[model samples]
Target: MTDPAKAARRARHDAIRAQVADEETEAAEAEAAENAATLDVSLHLRISHTLDAELRRRAAAEHIPTSALVRKLLAQAVRQHDACGLTAADVEEIARRVTREELHRSA
Candidate 1:
């Protein structure tokens, strides 16, 4: 049998530990909410099992979600492509030419 005073003290300690854990959880949730508010896009995708597992592992290692990892990768790719010396005017001209070609084909 345990002493009543010792049991009460242990119970109090457990209560304090639980309260601290609850506070930390709340703080983490608030930070995640703030991050979600800053995001501009919300997309959903279905991937193969192998790819999904790999993405999940990578995201865990990077401390981000799979979506965030993919977004960062896409942004980097776009920046690299844009740095290849093609101006915005060139892109516009190409788009115009493609549109004309498509229109003529459909005629």
Candidate 2:
């Protein structure tokens, strides 16, 4: 024979735990879908032997795939180019700004 009060308490505790587990699972799935939505897939160019080796080495050092490394770099480059409609002069200006920032930060 089981105590009715103890059985009621146990049932309530189990229900609360189950509800928490369900909420966590729902939140995790929603986050995964949100992340997936931001992912872009498109055709990529193949590089030559030297470039491929360099990319592979860099990617390995960073613990990312070569394609991911290339994608990150290309995305940054595209964003910079698009930001100011970058020309040759804009590239030089940006390089100067970056160098100045690096030197200033290091000092």
Candidate 3:
């Protein structure tokens, strides 16, 4: 015959373990949500003629497609921007500030 007290203790232990597991799952989900919120999203830019020309030259020099080169450069820029503790807005503003310098350099 099973001991009623032992059965009750086992039930309580199982319930406690289940609750702990549920809490951990909730915490993990919250963390995943936070990380997703911090991830950078992709963008499609309509490049000006000068920018397109530069991209074509650069890509040809590297023997890669223009689109691929743009994607690679943009990914690197985003990583560097984030590494410097800059938000997307900061990156955009900095890029805008440097656009003239870049265009002149390309010219």
Point to the candidate with the largest TM-score.
2
Query: Least lDDT summed over 10 consecutive residues: which range in candidate 2?
Result: 26-35
Candidate scoring better on TM-score of 2 and 3: 2
lDDT (Cα, tens digit) per residue for candidate 1, span 1-107: 57998999999999999997876676567557756777766777877999889888987676666666777777889999888897899999999999999999999
Clash statistics: count for each candidate: 0, 0, 0
Lowest summed lDDT window (length 10), candidate 1: 26-35
Those runs of model 3 whose alpha carbons end farther than 4 Å from true positions after fitting are 1-43, 86-107
Which digits, one per residue and each the tens of the lDDT, describe model 2 over residues 18-69? 9978766765665556458766557767669999999989976765556667
TM-score of 1: 0.41
Give the candidate order by descending lDDT.
Answer: 1, 2, 3
lDDT of 3: 0.77
The collision pairs in model 3 are none
| lDDT value, residue 107 of candidate 1 | 100
Which is the leading candidate under lDDT? 1
Q: What is the lDDT of residue 51 in candidate 3?
A: 86
Clashing pairs in 2: none
Task: Please provide TM-scores, in order, for all candidate models, with all chains considered together.
Answer: 0.41, 0.42, 0.39
